[model samples]
Target: MARVVWHVPVTTSGPGSTTALRLFRLRDGRRCAVGFSSPAALAALLGPDQAHTELGEPALHALTTPLGVDVLVLDPRLVAPPVTAPATPAAPAPTALLQHR
Candidate 1:
């Protein structure tokens, strides 16, 4: 029987561009890799537009271990607050200039 594969996120600059495995940092500043059990699970945390690939558990570890990333976070929970747009000040109305006679 084949081993269960996990969904691993990847980043690509554009079409036909080389892809790189997306790595994450822990709260302690340690680097680690992330994997999800399914595509839906991956999308839920990273959004629907996230790109991902499938790999077995061993393969995921092998790829990350070489980069000093030994930890693997499976189905991680959201710990940080959601990002919001900054409030911008409204622009002042334009004033008409008087012409000198």
Candidate 2:
């Protein structure tokens, strides 16, 4: 029998460029780890630019358990579009001041 593996999202952390498992929060604010059954499933929910790695279900659980994360969401559907921050306004140029002798 073929074993099932999942695509887990990851983010770079610290100066050493270590990869960390990306966790999500539920509507109630509880933290949960997320994984996708396929690369397409992951991209559909998190977009094509998201970074990920492949792991089995047991491996995913082992990595998340220590972080107090017990829930593993697989192939989750989005109820709404993802939110993004508004762009920051450009800074104004400094003006030269004339000094009086």
Candidate maximizing lDDT: 1
lDDT of 2 at 49: 85
For residues 1-101, could you state the per-residue lDDT of candidate 2 as single tens digits?
79999999998875579998888888888999888999999998899988999999899999989989999988887766679775887678998999999
Task: List, residue by residue over 1-101, the lDDT tens digit for candidate 1.
Answer: 96888899999989999999999999999998999999999999999999999989899999999899999999887889889776897678989999999
Write out the backbone clash pairs for model 2.
none
Q: Could you say which candidate leads in TM-score?
A: 1
In order, candidate lDDTs are 0.92, 0.89
TM-score of each: 0.77, 0.72
